[model samples]
Target: MASVHWAIQPVLALFVASSVLLTGAVERSPPSFVVDLDKPAYERWNSVIDANPDLGRDAPEIFKILTGNINMSNDTWGILFLMAEKIHKRLPAPFKEELQGMADRAKMPISLITLINLAYDLTAHCTSVVSTDANGTIWHGRNLDYNATTYLEKYTVHVDFKRGGKVAYSGVTFAGFAGMLTAIKPHAFTFSSNERDVGSFLENLLEMMDPNSKFLMVLIREVLEEAKNFREAISKFSLARMPAAIYVILGGLSNNEGVVLTRNRTHVIHEFAINMQSDRWYVLQTNHDPWLGDPWYDNRREAGETAMNRTGRNNITVDSLYDVLSVPKTRNKYTVYSTVMSASHPEAIRTWIRNSTELIPPPPVRASASNVVGRFGTFAAVLIVLSRNL
Candidate 1:
């Protein structure tokens, strides 16, 4: 009996291997065509950010707040921590240690400090405006309206900053001009949809500052470059003739544990589309990770989870920008350097698209015999009248 069992086990193993090989052969057919363009645009943009220290100079302030700078409010601390956590690894060790020191002085763990720092950065840098309605609900400049209970859902991009002689927190409303424009218009601008206009506005405002400071120009150029790459990638990858739009959300994560958790941060591209379909918007989402080979994604997830357990909510979601832009099932088959999405948040986008009126009428069919005969009689009468007049 033992001998028979061993013999059968080997046979079963062989059967399983054969089955796998057969499945692989069936699915291994080459694609009819391939898009093999090397995406150096995104790479260049990332390199610019990596090499520029001034671009992220304000990051440490947020980091200091995250490391338990009780002087700062929770909202301020939260936003900064999130930004720090996202971009921590991309920073040099000296910069990282400086931030860590700030966190240590505030008596917060590095992870918590970083998470809050990230949240702050997202709120401050990405957010365009924040307004409060009669209901006390906060709206981000991007047009996302959220009840006070769900602050995070209120904006596509969140940024907390000092304003109006006080530390003010604001978000880009996901329901306003930014969101609406992004939903309907083709994403062709460089930097951001609002970058050109925003840059202009900033220039006007910066006129009041000391012109000798090259900071403003440097910052504007950096922003413009980032936005340009984003627009170029979207234009290149978006499905042709489709009423779809795409957005590129760039952020970073740490990888202290030393494992690459995400590939090009493109994992979320398909998930974004699936979510849009689920929401009824047929948009595409694209994500690009300059640190694709880096171990930041895994480190960030693990660290975020750990910090989230300690803090009330893990600000990070399971469906990251990367997850929404890239399809996981076909990761090995196709590598997407950029992901496209119909909408940033599919559920809401579907509602908007479906609710909107149709632009064109359906095609008209050819007239049947009886209808054609009636039309012909009318045409004959008109022709006879015209002929008599001639």
Candidate 2:
């Protein structure tokens, strides 16, 4: 049996590599593509799935492996399974049907699809800066850091919702996932999330089961669709009981106002004003909660504060935002993409995606069969998307 498995593994590796190469995704830099969410949700997802057929199978498996690496137990998986089932029943029909379409097209279980979208407890570290220049142009910059091992090809360019009467907005996200981790509604506001805490497993499960429970992304979507200005946006956010712990930052061009809101499963813990006073023209958030006491937190917090201060409001620009976001001390090696949003003109969004070659770690000097197996795993994660101008 061991001999059979070893022989088949090499063949499977060759097949996957060939598949990726044939798609023409391997030869060029990875590209981003935009989706018009105004179209039926299912139709939009199906189109992307059709374009990258292998991703349908790859995504769920990636999540499964990730869950295991994180020491999540079978009992925890069971809880997530139940939560995914309940969350499906609670989602709006359009989004629910979208997951079903993706599952059918990808030939994967609907529960797995739901689990990938709903599970927000990741060891991702991100830094979001909401700032307004002297000219009143509000800018939101974010660096989304995560394990690049399996997430390289899952990246989606942007999701646009113009005709749905749903806050004409757009931003980049993962393929097939319904949640919006980053978005900017043109002429309305721009917002992003940085994971702060996973919260208790029991609380998260309960939040998922409650019919009235609303995930953070769902609540943010509502704010985008309905809120007309900064005040209205915060009002809506203030009322929501998010399902996980996250530090959310929102910016509006109308008032040049930016807010940093922190929430757990039950209530809003802290909300701070950013880019409010003339002297304080920016805000920063990383993985750790600000109020917590720790030396590492102090160092990172001071570094971010110093970076913002050195740039000065008079000198800040979109390019400068990227430079600060890319600072080695601030971002982890897992950083996959960085984005800059101009809230005043939301149509102007810029992103820098990590190259596929960077996905694989350096090979050790003395190689073994285990190293080959590890390379195979990395190869599977390197599925490609055809380059498209965004």
Candidate 3:
């Protein structure tokens, strides 16, 4: 890519990865669209056309790949969307109008648009960390992973949510998704959603149909727009009846203000925080419950914690924190992007669209007489297959 795209990847790898190999640049992603909440809801995504122009051409294909994992015919899926919509009036005020505008612009169905927006909730494979350095400056960081990383990283953009013509909050997301997965409230706090897949997607879908339920993404948006500090956000988010169980990590402007809230439907079962007294200055959460530890297969939590501890408190900064998160095992092939933020230092909100070679999924394989393989995203697997073909 152009020099403009090559921002922090090399320096980050060199600084953070003492042993792992890294190639290509993690592009400093551009803003796809800006949503002005003060305007009519349907007009909020208007800038999407000019800012992220390819969204119109790519929406259908993006949606198709996202739903590719699910087994259902188009007709059956259409019926399911309608049934869910009938039972649950989910698109409240700005979201429905915003979606309507996006659908009209993209020439896609509103139901499918809404489905993908909410789909971000169901596929919540991600890692989040909140830590304070020796000076007690809290830095919040996260890596969002999804099966559709190939598509998402291409259109990855930073969205600025504006109210009264000012940036109220912002987050890194794809072109068409309207909800918030990772967000920052200026000088208040930074928070992110990690999927707690204790229950199946069907259970979450049933909860979505309850009409009273709210997607965690929407709730995160609400928290960013509503809450002004760490404790307020914690109190409001902890009591929230989220449609599914999830972990919300919060990092605040003040010292020792970082905490991970482990929540179910209506209550926060536990609060894990930065313990300066015990020298546990960082809290990490992946897809699993933090206390039980990440499963042997998904070692993101373990790997991330190791990176954090390795980046000693005296040496922690934005670049160092990004390095901590750039570990190959932690930021794997499925990672779409990495966002680093500090509520205390709101001016330097940084997000990098992860596009390095190791993070890229293998290209689609051509049909061969001996094999009909589809994809081999891992580097070693791709190398092995390439050698066989050669």
Candidate 4:
């Protein structure tokens, strides 16, 4: 694994602390990070794995970064296999074929990819906000607060999936999973999942392997690919028993409304509406489950709602939304990347990534011709790993 060292300047203490609090990160400068994956599934993955052989060596550590201290014992794999066997029959054909192609091209085990996909939602928390700007542009924003570590920083990926007749969707995420933490399917809807800790973490995880269970990520991907509207997306959730507890925020571009569905293993416990009326036009969420109040959960939820109210929906732009998302009172040590999107406008998605520097700036450099190729290769590798996870 590669590492970058940071020097804390006594004088810059204020600046460093402010940056982390304001931006949910400390700096913008990163050392040599691997390429970002973005490609059509068939052509891009093989080149990615070839470029980053280190991924193989780092898999276990990477898994730890995402899943926390959970022991990946033989029993874990056994459960994953059984879960995959059941879920496999439910995935769309095109996606399954593409996933298999990714595994073949990457030369890794398909089960590895399946495990990563199934495990993605295991131990993560996030924030999701939905509101409309003055122009009535529906905005959906999400901040992924994963377990913190430098290794996890460099391996993030962005994927764009286009299946012939279905709406196209894309977003940034980790490799080795087909589910979504954040993504937008233009003209259709935008979606994100915020982890909600409800009961015994380990008990919930073990229950996820039941043959009747539908993993949240896989279910989200299904809706992204097939659902034609926001109503359909919500209906999809209403019909299935989600594998775990989570908050699914789905905003429809066409209808210009967003709903936050709180779910557990059996049914939807509560639902919140994010309607863009003239007066009250915003929605906010954090790691805490409103149903099961936790004072210990960070105060950022209140801070974020206040920030949104201060900015006001009428004044919210992509940059302004980023500003709101960056507020320290609304962030934590593990809060990594922030994404804001125009849910109704297909390609209008913006992502702010954290770097190793104390004073955060924009993403390292612009994509040149060579960098473009590398970006494509990286995207392919990530897709391959996520979809194919050997």
Model 1 misplacement above 4 A: 1-107, 117-230, 233-390
Q: Write the per-residue lDDT of candidate 4 for residues 1-390, one digit (tens) a residue.
A: 011112322222333356656646334322221222344444544544454455545655555446544444464445445555454545554446445655565565665555556557666778889887777677898777766335545556666664553436776676545566888877767888887777544455456646577777767767876788778888897678766788888777632487788877788888877654545577677767665544764777776776777667666676666666766655555666777886577666767565423333323223344544654454334433333332
TM-score of each: 0.20, 0.76, 0.84, 0.73
Top candidate (TM-score): 3
Model 3 CA deviation exceeding 4 Å by range: 1-26, 53-68, 84-89, 356-390
> Candidate 1: deviation at residue 325, Å?
21
| Candidate 4 residue spans exceeding 4 A from truth | 1-17, 20-52, 70-104, 164-167, 254-256, 276-278, 291-294, 356-390
> TM-score ranking from best to worst?
3, 2, 4, 1
Tens-digit lDDT track of model 1 for 1-390: 001122323333333244334434221111111111132221212222232233233334433332222244354444433433544444433335544554444444555544433322222211111112223221111211111112222112211122244322111222111111222111212112211111221122222122222221122223322333333334332222211112332211111100111111112132121121233211111122223321443232232222223222121122122221111211111111111122122221111111001111124233454645654454445434433332
Q: Lowest-scoring 10 consecutive residues by lDDT in candidate 1?
A: 349-358
Residue 336 CA error for candidate 3 (Å)? 0.4
Candidate 4 accuracy as TM-score: 0.73
Better of 1 and 2 by TM-score: 2
Q: Going through the candidates in order, what is the number of backbone clashes in each?
A: 69, 0, 0, 16
Give lDDT tens digits, candidate 3, residues 163-182: 88898988887666777778
Model 2 pairs whose backbones collide: none
Q: Point out the higher-scoring one by TM-score: 1 or 3.
A: 3
